[model samples]
Target: MNPTQKMSLQAIDLVGPSQPLVSLIINNYNYAAFLAEAIDSCLNQTYPRIEVIVVDDGSQDGSPQIIESYGAKIIPVLKANGGQASAMNSGFSVSAGEIVIFLDADDYLIPNAVETIVARWQPETAQLHYRLTVVNTEGEAVGFCPSPGVQLATGTVWPILLKRGRYHSNVTSGNAFSRSALDKVLPIPETDFRIAADGYLVGAVPFWGSVAAIEEPLGCYRQHSSNAWSNSQSTEDPQKLVKRLRWALKHDLHRYYWIQHQAKALGHPTQENLGLRDYMHLIDRLASLRLDPEQHPFASDASAGIARKGIGAVWQQDCLSTGRKLALLGWFAIAGFMPSLFATPTIEWFLLPTSRPQFIQKTIRGIKSLRVA
Candidate 1:
């Protein structure tokens, strides 16, 4: 049964009594200024059975105090600074709800966002999935954005999922899933890496069970100066972006290897996870580097045979490998991973018009030429 059917059944049980439960997990860090707005957005949800969890990863800033201002209504889990993944993990650790949703500290939720999303969640199953509505700082419909295994293009998720693959390579954090679906994929690895944990998690979920999608803007995406992957990311040093990409790759590789091992240990199939060839590939790549086994984190005997394939497996599956893939990967490794170097060209390429006037005339002519036949 889907969320609507489940809600309908529940409504029948209630005989016009009460509402279903929804747990909203907010992963907060140091954004004290924007914290209240994020929290308030949830508080104002049209759905009344919503429980809010604000996990604070030791903000030296006064974010903790801001959360405290909410008193008991907003459950606040305070902890030492543990990157975003750890903070998110902590948030889920304490959530008690049929479904789970994430609201970042810097972003606010649209009014009735929770109600809209929960309406689509299927309470009859252990898992639920849905598409999200992406909005800018102003509440207007700007365009679609990407999330793990989910992307928004004029309010559609199917095209991106089918074309891009199960894991959303671009964005994934602000999506909704059944708590049961989450428990199976919980405790996102506590890596020192600062990005891409959400992407890795999305990739891992398909193996768990029936994943689903819905077309609606479930929340508001705040685009501002302090967001981790902000609009200004294009202006950053190319080296920093490259470093971030490499780290993301490493983290994803680690998850793939681990999932592969878990599958083999349970005597299940390995196609969904890593394979023997995948482990071998990792070994050969490390050998090519000739790094001292004692010095590198990936050199341990335990980690050695994790995946046996070379770059072939990774590159083959990576869809982002357009013509520019190699050069971009090169930037990540050789050119200090500069984001600007890659972005400037991309921006210019997209902005350039072959012949603006001609294109406009053709477009107008085509529209005018449309006929009933």
Candidate 2:
């Protein structure tokens, strides 16, 4: 037997037979170079009851051949070039396990990852969010993404999820979902979100049931040039940066709009989640500000309304600290009054207080380097 297979067998021998079955669905496109490592990671997990499935989204690379090499070890589903959402839906349609993890082709699990996840899962838990170590393309560990900072005091977390945006404290590869939760959320709405399908699921699942969390790093998230988020960070050109910012702003606005729609459909109180209401109002105000007050008659009054009620509402909430509420108000005021300010790196510094100073400094250095060249 090959070394990987033998190691997997050894690990399986250590796991108890009574463990619940977990499905690891690896979604891939052209990431052939990293595919095997991801699959091997799943195969080598200490948890014995796992079914590995690879869904190939019409990759032109040798990913199909690499998947074929696994043979009977993993189930392979090949389909036409659909986006990540489509691949996810295709994978979920065939999964039979009680727990499911949508593993990215570029990310892989730690040795005892699955075991840790299963151990922490409760019958009432709809999803479990675990920590993940961040790595570069070379597979060297960089840092870790932590679990949600706000403690979930109750069984239902829809209120907290709406208060904090969907992307906050969430890593797609670091989550495991109960089959029942997946049943409620899926088949994923591919048309609404062709990419970032996890964002949709993360936003929706909390409403269905409870969520648990594990702070220990259980997987590795590789950031590279090909990753969508990484691509925006790797550039320093002013025009490109501005374009990326606009795209991100619009994307976030779209996500918030979708969330608002979904929450209404699910009969959740969108008003009680002051953060959501504030964000929606802020986005609307910004959109209005982009046009002339004469052209958009409501622009001036709406912006003023948000600055009062929307910002005031969030500031009154107990969930956010004084500093966070101040920051939120500042962000909305600046973005509403001077939307062009975001075109510069200043917006990054304003919104992300932790890392944006370094980002802004790096961006300035890159601009200087271009001038020198």
Candidate 3:
């Protein structure tokens, strides 16, 4: 045999088993508009050893048809409307890959996404995270979201999760989790996670092992008003902003309650809980207080208390840029010291992208692009 051919065969043998199969699970619920693109992205991943599983959560639209159209190219899970968590549980039960990724139907991965995650895989890692480009309903780039800081929060991040109840991690589509990590926390409580199912997983997975980060965009996260989780929508209505803050508050609380249980089970109980110390949550609290003081949830939550805690949060935030910190600091001050009537409008301006002047939105989007760059 030729020496080169023999060496190649020997190298193959030394490299051990075939590449691990990656299960790309796409969860859909009335996202038929974008379902096909999401499935195509998974099927077309650069990684050769991968399986695409599409879970339709009783989508009434064309989602089932799209899934059917994929034929044998993908595995299909059709079930009654059970929300995001149920769909996730259903999908993973049938999956057989060493690496697993849950891609949202409204999102699509770049060709190299799975290939890159597989290349970066480590035996000790529980999960790997990457950034995502924010896009509109029409698939147009609308903005970018940076990691919570200059560098992603990685490695033994349970302590961060314990104190702050959050870390630098992206939504569902931006993460590829080890099967070992997922096994520990699967069957996510359906009712608790009907929306933002990724939040529970993101918090629970890091406790099992070290986490990793890719630090660049791997997919597109489409945002629109009709989204199940309407974060970063382009709506300008004042009442809608108030309603969103309330929804965010509830979601954050659910995340904390669930993660706390996961942590205690692992013997990593939090000595001091900083769950409410989150800057964004505080912003939500402060804004809610101003917008509708009568219905504000926290009884002891005064504007001053929120501002003080928010200042501390912003100061210690490892994920945000200095400019962002400064802006938040100024916001807290206004919300704390200014009259409610004045601060309410200002808060809405910051919270709603459509409320801002076009130039300002363009400028902010431009600045955020540098973070991903």
Candidate 4:
């Protein structure tokens, strides 16, 4: 650690009871190979006073044994297989920290992530605020940020969001949250949303809290060919691709439905959308579905003609770049014939945060004031 980092840790140690220690809650599900690294990264933080909670989602991979290796510093919770959302809900229920953070088992935080996040939390107008931070995996920057008119929900809306790419594509899972925020947004439903649950949780956050952006790389996200969806994409096998496509379609539809729900819930107009790209993609996906013989048992000739017309319209609209247009055309063809491969990007880049000078100036001032006293 640098001298500045050493001093920062010393200062955090000096913070009083008025400032509660942040809790880092990680949801582990059979990723034992990566769990230790994630935990170790938390252990090496320059900021002091963080409790680590690991919820093992019934991993028969002996993940419980690995977590136990950390002894008391890391608390391990074992539950039946209830998926990521349930694991998070379980961790949230037991954590006592005033500020809560959720970290995925495969991801880890940067050295000063907690300190930087805590600095952004002291809003004069509210108890909890949504802080945005940038991160890089393997030393490469992931350029993603929230766009204008886009509001943040609680914690971090990483895996499930429309304007997700605006926050950086390679964001790690260890995002900090204020305790009050969780209290207000509790019992995050353990829905069987194959892909877009994170978006729903984020959209559900109230608009009253403040939103801050932290412009520093705080962690690493390890991506490999062995992930859950990786194999589905690697095969020419029709059944596998079909299964993947169905999951994607259902997930995206659910995401859009919830986006509308949250917009209305917050008294915001449901139709004033930011992700035109997503909307186009949705339409493209829907239009492609007209070709499946099984899906449309009757009127085979009409369905084929409609599919050709829809594909031609997408090509002529030039809604995307040449490559994106071609890609969409190909996807449309696949969706037409195979009727699969439809879903939201687990990590998305919908609307980017406004680059207006006022917001920039405000962010600059806040960051400039974050140095250790």
Candidate 5:
């Protein structure tokens, strides 16, 4: 570790009872290979008043043995086979801290993660969303930030969510939830969120109050074979790409339904059509329609239909620059009007990150800070 990091860790190690009791929960399954590393990162946290919980959703592998070996160093829950949402529900049931962070078993945190998170937490904050650095199997940062550089304006942004259908957010490990807000939001719909439970949390929590943003990488999100979604076109086999788009469709609509549910419970207006106003989902719909029209879920959705709805969404997008809107509009017009053979690569180039040249990723990051001006 560098001197700067060492000194920072030393500073947080001395934190006292004045700090809120933060609970770091690691939800695991068949990730025995990465389980121990995840546990150590939490147990070794510099922030003093904290509890670490690991909920293993019945891994037939050696995961149980690893959890057993941890003994009292961590709280262990080895239950019958359930999905990600089930594991989170189990972890949240036993967690006793004011601030609860659900860390994926494959991800590890910086020593001061809890300290940094709690400092940003406010009385009305429903959840804290932070950025994460992508790491390889060898655990080195690959210079990628998963957050899409959109910040929901502070305070209740549910109106923004209803209008846009969703906000830019990160994966499971990059968020921390306020326990009180989660009490009203969680017990995540097990059937709907069987795999990506984070989607549910990110959408539902913002309804009760405000959401906070931390613009730094507090942890390392590891990409391995089991859940590896790549960005490179070379690795993008057509079958796999189609499968991913189908799943994205299901995942996007699932979150939208819950967002609608949250808005209605609070007596807020909701869109009449499912995800019709969502910008990113429209891109996915356009691609799916071109790639596999027969199996496409939206019967009435033609490329032009998606483009028209998406153009309106582009104008309604939060935290976007005019340059970005123009680029999106041009791409939509091209993809919507072009032949399938040409349109497929056109959309894939913009849709897949690895398909992007290194300079384009850098350009996206460079323009990440630009606003309406």
Candidate 6:
């Protein structure tokens, strides 16, 4: 390991393994088929001190029965369908763990996941992120999502999260947050972010304190047709796909703005706050490119101006590769000049085909297998 990485590990080791109570909050909303496995995973955890809380957001499916079957093993919180954020808020209200991990209903943890997290826990660390393996509906391991850069870094990751525009590095199921951190950022602000509730939490947590990361894949992220985000990929018609993308872009823009407002309210404005401004501006320029390209002759110029600013920020992120940065730059250029191109069905199909390319899929499987080995 490099000297920096060694030192970070040493620091974590110095904290020693103090296995405090951990709360695994499983949020469910009609994911009956996968609910049992998720609870079972928690029940089977290697960690000794854990309280499993299953929050059922008025699931019409048989999920309630399954959660009830867990009986005394897990605390069941049944509430009206107030979305993921509300369910998490409810769960957090009843939880009594020093560390909290929000595990999605469709995803489950590895037996040793909580154990690994506790091993690295320190008094000052606000958040900890680890890798997660992606699985299909049949529970087959597909691939892994690796945090783009500085996976072992144990400090502020706000800048890295902002420059990338999303928390692609850490999945909700694979993250653990200190109770102190949650006290600062949660009850989740009661926003319109249903699917990307984790995004809001992920964005705000780092400001409270340092974020440590583990390179190990400690949980499984199930990608299926029912997933709010993944369901858009199944759209076959080009116009429909474009509409979905537009809606998604708008949704993300709103979420970012909300986080920015939260940061300012909390009086912890960082470079990410400015980054969110540039991102929102970029989205507005792209919208202009799509809506009134003829009226705004300088739309492309405005888009390029914002794109360059974003590129500069992205270029400094160690989590992204050179090619990824260039790809983002190219995407910005396209969004500026030919916004409709992304909306086109042909391009959408090629980029997010129902079946991903075999070579790429094979490469991911190979990488995950190596990690497992």
Task: Assess every candidate by TM-score.
Answer: 0.63, 0.74, 0.92, 0.61, 0.88, 0.78
The digit string of per-residue lDDT tens for model 1 on 1-373 reads: 8999999998787853345577887888788878888889889998878899998888889998898899988888999887877877888888887777766777777777777766665544333344445555555654445432223222233222222233432244356667776777677777733444565455444445544554555556666656655542433353444333344345646756545543454465545433223422343333222222343334343322332233343344443323223432322232122344543433222222222356544653454344323
Candidate 2's displacement at residue 279, Å, is 5.7
Reference-based lDDT, each prediction: 0.55, 0.71, 0.84, 0.54, 0.82, 0.72
Output the number of the lDDT-best candidate. 3
Candidate 2 achieves a global lDDT of 0.71
- Compare the candidates by TM-score and give the number of the best one: 3
Ten-residue stretch with the least lDDT total in model 5:
227-236
Name model 1 segments beyond 4 Å from true. 1-19, 123-142, 147-173, 192-194, 258-268, 271-373
Supply the global lDDT for candidate 3: 0.84
lDDT for 132 in candidate 6 is 90
- lDDT by residue (1-373, candidate 5, tens digit) is 9999998988877665557898888999898889999999999888888999999999988999999998998899989978999999999999999999999998989889888998888988888878888887789777545544454345666777788877766788888888999999889999998888988988898898888888788999887776645432235566667778888899988999899998899898788665788888888888888878999998988898898888888877756655566667766887888887778777777776557668766765565555564
Q: Candidate 4 lDDT, tens digit per residue, 337-363? A: 552333222101011122224654464
How many residue pairs clash in model 1?
A: 27
Q: What is the lDDT of residue 249 in candidate 2?
A: 48
Candidate 2: stretches off by over 4 Å: 1-17, 146-155, 162-167, 249-266, 269-345, 348-373
* Model 4 TM-score, 2 decimals: 0.61
Give the Cα-based TM-score of candidate 2 against the true structure. 0.74
lDDT measured at residue 180 in model 2 versus the true structure, 0 to 100: 93
Worst 10 residues of 6 by lDDT: 364-373
Worst 10 residues of 4 by lDDT: 344-353
Candidate 3, residues 182-270: lDDT per residue as tens digits?
99998898988888899899988988999999888999988876684555445766677778778888888888887888878977756
Question: Model 5: how far is 254 from its true place, Å?
Answer: 1.7
Model 5 clash number: 2
- Whose TM-score is higher: candidate 1's or candidate 3's? 3
